[model samples]
Target chain A: MTKQDTRPRPKAGPAEPDRPQRRKAAAAYPYAFYLPAGIVYVVIFLIPTVMAFYFSLTRWTLFDSTFVGLENFADFFAEQNLSIGFRNTLVYAVLTSGLKVVLGMLLGVLLTSRLRLRGFLRSVVFFPVLVSTVAVGITFSVLLKPDTGLVDRALALVGVSGHDWLGDATTALLSVALVDVWKGVGLATVIYIAGILSIPPDYYQAVEVDGGTAWHRFRHVTLPLSRPATYSVIILSFIGGLRSFDLIWTMTRGGPGFTSDVIASIIYKQYQAGFYGLSTAGNVMLFLVVSAIVIPLSWFLGRREIA
Target chain B: MRTFRRVTAEVVALVVAGVVFLIPFSFMLLTAVKDSVQAAELDFSWPTSWPIVANIAEVVSARDYVLLRAYLNTTVLTVGSVAITVVFAAMAAFVLQRRAGRIGALANFLVLSGLIIPPAIVPTIWLLQALGLFKTMPGLILVEVAFGLSFAVLLFRAFIAGIPRELDEAAMIDGCTGLSLFFRVIFPLLRPVTITVILTMSVTVFNDFVNPLYFLPGDENATVQVTLYNFQSQYSTEWNLLFMDIVLITIPPLLAFVFFNRKIVAGMTAGAVKG
Candidate 1:
């Protein structure tokens, strides 16, 4: 009986239908579906990236070129403001991302709670995300002007005198970083809200059953579980802050004699100065700095996520 | 009593956040209608007389109606880029999800890296020059689509995983093949993700500054953000007109967000969380 069953199963498996149709469809589709996007990505993104590496080694204007090995990199590093730009970039990125994480999580928790006018409030917070960054920079620059700006005037009402917000060397970078946080925290909050919502209710219920108060529940459940969102918020904002140019360019233009120059603005200044090779090197360096920080951070978070 | 305290606390928090967020925008709007004198004062005092229509007209007519031209150019750029990104990303996503192989895995890595790595602008300009697309509208369009494709493809791939393979097989059994099968059967089912991509990408491309600054430099090809340069010069103090320009350029995307607020939030968060 066993031998007869095995013989019949082999025949049925060999003669099973639909395999030919599936194979035909597979053959027809091939991998050409990836062609359109693949072509665009390769031409516009991938090739430029590969060329960036090569071009950074060559001293080239728009119409001329000469190979200069690592001289551009040396010159980029040796520039008078390079060290300040590097330092400012780190400070700006850290300040913005750190504030964004804390503020975003706070707002997210509040908005996700049983609050009044939650939807309207969320919209209000997120409205800035839609505004153009350049516009935001300009508006804030106007508002934050030393004395005549609305911000200072409003401060005067409360008996606090306003100083140069974006003009003074001391406050320029920090001021821009604060605006960055304001414009970006909305996104961070949205992400955190999504993360908080995704947490299963059972965890909270379990905490309650164990006599955990709201604080305790949040401390033990929400905070730990929202790790993924926090990771993303930090990485996204950090990268954004590192690559920040438009706001700085529009707001300060590395004002007060190069006090607020981040790496990107520095690169743009080089490009404006016709140091194409040096700017390309700066771009590569910025790329390296971002990836070096973000990749490992992501890996660490990912491993923790699985664990 | 505890519940009352909690409620009051929540209300306080909400109001504070609302004020912080809304004040900048409200001030922008207020200044938009103010006269040049009132704008120079830069105080919170309400405009004594609203000249909103006049301000709009002036901004519209400034520099040979450059703002209107910018609006047209931006609309073209946004629509064209979003359309290309959606179609190409959807097709690529469908194949990447359905067809698992070595090449697909490499493609996946490339897409992911595109999200992390910064675009090298100088070389990109060079390549565009080589292709005779530098300083051209079509070049800028291609740049937008390329930069946006990674996020769209990632979102589509996540959404597509929930769709069972049996649907493809079932469609194929009914004589649907290749483009017909995708367009007829599968594409219709991807409407939610499609809307998400469209709305999100449209807002992003429309609001983008750097790409247009680098790739499309001519005044004739100015996007809305680029037109900010018109109002702002090295030593000009046209705060009123500049604020008016801000209000005008901001209206379309701002209105889009207000109307589709829920979908935009959902779509944006969905991409981030899933990614």
Candidate 2:
């Protein structure tokens, strides 16, 4: 414990003002308080990030490495699955984030409205968010097994046959995206509900005074005011979808010939195959992609938020 | 008549959302209590006889009680990480809020970047290996705290801004200095946000899968999420046991969420909504 001496020293110089001395003393206190967290964060997180940049440029193993410059990046880029992985990553992010925003807003509005059992319904929707993603992935994989599974059984009752949801290349990524939305939409809805409820009733009353219909009130007041929540949902879900791995790994393992693979999963695959340096590069690229999108989008959203 | 129609419409919407959200969980529950023969069918039919106790017994005791070990390991990891995260984040956030300087601004940026950027896993593994902490519980605990620190710090900073600086001065005037002033005067005032951080961070760490998988790889260090991998194999067909495993692993956190539902939701959305 590096305890700072807190005893006030006798003033030696009369020219030094008390306020400046106090400010200096207060400044030193913050650094002391911040030291534990700063040291842990920098050592564990920041250093590894810097090390990743260096390691990404080397052909490394557990023991030794040779400088490979941009070869690892080139190899990662030239891999046959890279294009599909990139496309799938974008598609998955857009699909999940879009659906989460739309569905979450609708549900948020409904739950905040005069709905029966709204509390219970909110709990039910949020229950899955607490469950382990791997558990959800496993449970959904079994349910959507296409044959003799509960989902298919329910579909069959409607005279519809079910396909192998997780097995089919065409529907694999889409199906997983839907599950991602399912497991996640609860948080989005909660955020939207908070956002919507925070909008003063005066806004709605103004529309009502104008003889606005429900649609008009919603479109004119609720939708625009809830932009912050919508922005958050899009950013959170989109970044989550881009970096998604656990559920995909548990559910499909990026199977059906890399049709459903994202960049993160691809990176994991490289690591699993002992391509540590290549995977480190992949990780860096994933970070760059996420930062590239999120930072600018946040700035754009922040600007609009203020305006 | 109009009121009746509106109520009916709301009812229909609630039922639809409820069914969609809960069907998968109900399926998991139904499958977990059935015999192997029935579980293999994987339909929504009621089990002829409930074997929940038997299934739980077998799952808990399987393979040298590995699931039980996983439960213990996960509990330790969650508690350890949450304690560290809350304390460190609170201390840092307290300072960052009270003192705005260049270092504070840089710290804020680093914290925000942690939220936005995906962690580079391979290099982290190498670093951990170099420190002789790889594949160890402490290593995984440190990783969890590092990852969760950013969010906790952000939440606390938001909450701490509301606390006045006069309290600090008042405490200092009473001869309560650095650590004592924080512990005696400041930390107790941060009760609401502290609970929020504790519950949220605990849940996050408890439910985390990737960090545990990558950092702590061996069976001895298996967390609850890693135990799911043990339940599934390339050709295994024991759906009943598997579902039972899922149920057991899910119960603790699920109950925590249900009990602290409001706090968790408030804590999670606090930053997004307010900031």
Candidate 3:
């Protein structure tokens, strides 16, 4: 009459009669399997990250060094473009991620709405994600020219004037961020599309039963249910915007006087100027900035999942 | 289900996509064929005469065929890093999922950090110089693999979790040893996820611009993206040639998307869509 009598017998091959036999079986999946990847990841990614902190305090060429304490950090903060880079990084991340969330959700809803050309539209949107960022950046730089570019020409046809988009400090960062949205919003859209498609139909049916219109369905069902997708889009795009380099580099070169200079671009400029310690310091600052913004943001977004 | 709204949405999406996506590519094609003067204008106009062949020659021959060399270098970097990533990530993922311990948890954190944390580029270059790997293709390839590993490992780990534990036991009972158990039995079952990892990693490593720009400097190791960037200043006013370079370098990714469209979407959206 014991509870053990109700249990089914375990299969012979996997069922262990002794602890020793189970241990032996576990040996088949060795811990050594982690070594190869661990070696490469540590040597190439993690070690350098640890070394960045040490090297940032030293005025050294790659080969030789003399410790300079906090000079590099002070110089980095005082650098003419550093503040702009910091401001631009946050602005770029916010602007890009915001646009991506709104636009991606809308497009996601559109694509999942049982449209005729869903497949075609999805392909068209996501294809840009595969294109070269440098190529796209350059193309947009050309397109954003004041008078002769296609963007301005089209705007003129619509009775709107086009300004010097990339040449002006005021518009340069905004312009680059917009182009980024164009290239990247595809990724966000796909994520959103997947999230929307995975939603259970029962909720929508419940809305219908309650005489919910499309707007009501979206507001009540889709909006609340798609929080996971929204979270993913914001985090991924925000991080991407923070680390952004090639697009800004190719488009503006942090130019028109560093208005569009992001942290990554700032680091590159320091390195290019032979300020090795300063560049390494900039790298540390970027890491800190990314962590400060992202860690809290992700925690805030993720806390609701537990409930 | 609503045909009217669907059609309207479809038309609007089409127009927006056409203008945003289509016109720029069309401009690239058009500009690539135009004479230098018209190309420099950077306007949307039919070429008075299609100097497509000359443009191609000038672009391909520019800087003593640097673009062709870039294509070769990019292929090596992409293929090399992607292959290493698939094997290493799959192996590591296999262990990470099967073994539940502090080691596994720590490893998982590091892998995840690789995704969130930006690389310290200057320190990395210094380390590479110290190790005699700077300005070398192998160095850059390893860098790419390191960066690509985290995502691949996570994807493979997720996929691996779905694979039953019984498979490992069955194989082990058949006298399969440690590595062989993973390679012969577990690895083959990973084809679907493997393909996904391969496609996405290839696209990422191939289209990468900054890594090669920073790590693998010098014309000897110019990647496709670097070649395009270099062509920018070199051919500043040569719009036809510049666009030609852009067109040339864009093909591999374009071809990949065209053929493996579904797989790419599934692989990319796999993480974001899942809770």
Proportion of true contacts reproduced by candidate 1: 0.72
Q: B130-172, model 3: which lDDT tens digit per residue?
A: 8899999999999999999999998999999999998888888
Lowest summed lDDT across 10 adjacent residues in model 1 chain B is found at B229-238
For residue A186, what is the lDDT in candidate 1? 91
In model 3, what is the error at residue A294, expressed in angstroms?
Answer: 1.4
Q: After aligning candidate 2 to the native by TM-score, how far in Å is the CA of A260 from where it should be?
A: 0.9
lDDT per residue for candidate 2 within A88-153, as digits (tens), equals 888989999999999999989988988768898888887788889989989888888886777778
Q: Point out where model 2 deviates above 4 Å.
A: A1-28
The lDDT values for all models are 0.86, 0.86, 0.89
**Who is ahead in lDDT, 1 or 3?**
3
How would you encode candidate 1's per-residue C-alpha lDDT over B233-255 as one tens digit per residue? 72156677888888888888889
lDDT of 2 by residue, B201-228 (tens): 8878888988998899988779889988
Per-candidate DockQ vs. reference: 0.72, 0.71, 0.77
Consecutive 10-residue window with the lowest summed lDDT within model 3 chain A: A1-10
For A1-307, candidate 3 gives per-residue lDDT tens digits of 1334556656667544555554664587678888899999999899999999999999978888899999988876686678778888999999999999999999899889877888888888888899999999989989998988888998999999888999998999999999999999899999998898889999999999999999999999999999999999998998899999999999999989877899899999989999888889889988999999888888998898556
- The best-first sequence of candidates by lDDT reads 3, 1, 2
* Segments in model 3 whose C-alpha atoms lie over 4 Å from true places: A1-22, B1-6
CAPRI quality of model 1? medium
Interface RMSD of 1: 1.5
